[model samples]
Target: MNKPPRKKNPTFGIAIFIVVAVLLVIATLFYNAITEKREFDRQNAPEPTISSDAAAAAATTAKPASGAAQ
Candidate 1:
């Protein structure tokens, strides 16, 4: 006897598609957030201060040499 053909079930396929779509959307949002954060950091990064270097130079100059006595 010939067996009847199986009916295609769309429920599982639709569920998987929805899950994948949601995951993709979440991943895209996460990626966008990271990209925006990187851009913001690049734009708002602190400028290098020369005051520290100047302070170091001044300190070295102000110190008496080991060979010199006050």
Candidate 2:
């Protein structure tokens, strides 16, 4: 039995390597960008506001009810 000669595809291998490297670089850039965005958001996040019910309760406590003595 005679086997066919093997083919050496150097270009294909190099192309694959280049494509993989490019994809890795792109993925790294995207990951870093997302991480930086999250960090920025965490740092600059707004302070939580008091709920309306809590605010109203506080207001009521601080000030006397209507017609109460001053």
Candidate 3:
């Protein structure tokens, strides 16, 4: 069995490497844009943000009312 002659071009490998690198950079940018858009939408969604201090104060004040009712 005779194998086909291989083409000898050292630059061919470099060309392929450059193409792959560009593709990877484009893919990364695309992925980052999509993730950022999703995050932006999530921030704009109708979810309420509560502070930890306000939550703790509410819990402490409610405890005495519940105990008095019992």
lDDT of 1 by residue, 1-70 (tens): 9999999999999999999999999999999999999999999999768997888788878677799988
Clashes (backbone N, CA, C under 3 Å), per candidate, total 0, 0, 0
Candidate 3 C-alpha RMSD relative to the actual structure: 6.4
Note the Cα lDDT for every prediction shown: 0.93, 0.92, 0.88
> Which scores higher on TM-score, 1 or 3?
1
C-alpha TM-scores of all predictions:
0.67, 0.63, 0.54
Q: State the lDDT of candidate 3 residue by residue for 1-70, as single tens digits.
A: 9999998999999999999999999999999999999999988887555686678778778355555856
Which candidate should be chosen as best, given lDDT against the real structure? Answer: 1
Arrange candidates, best lDDT first.
1, 2, 3
lDDT agreement of model 3 with the native: 0.88
| Of candidates 3 and 2, the better by TM-score | 2
Q: Give the best candidate by TM-score.
A: 1
- The segments of candidate 3 whose C-alpha lies over 4 angstroms from its true place after superposition are 1-7, 46-70
| Residue-pair clashes, model 2 | 0
lDDT of 2 by residue, 6-66 (tens): 9998999999999999999999999999999999999999876779668878877866779
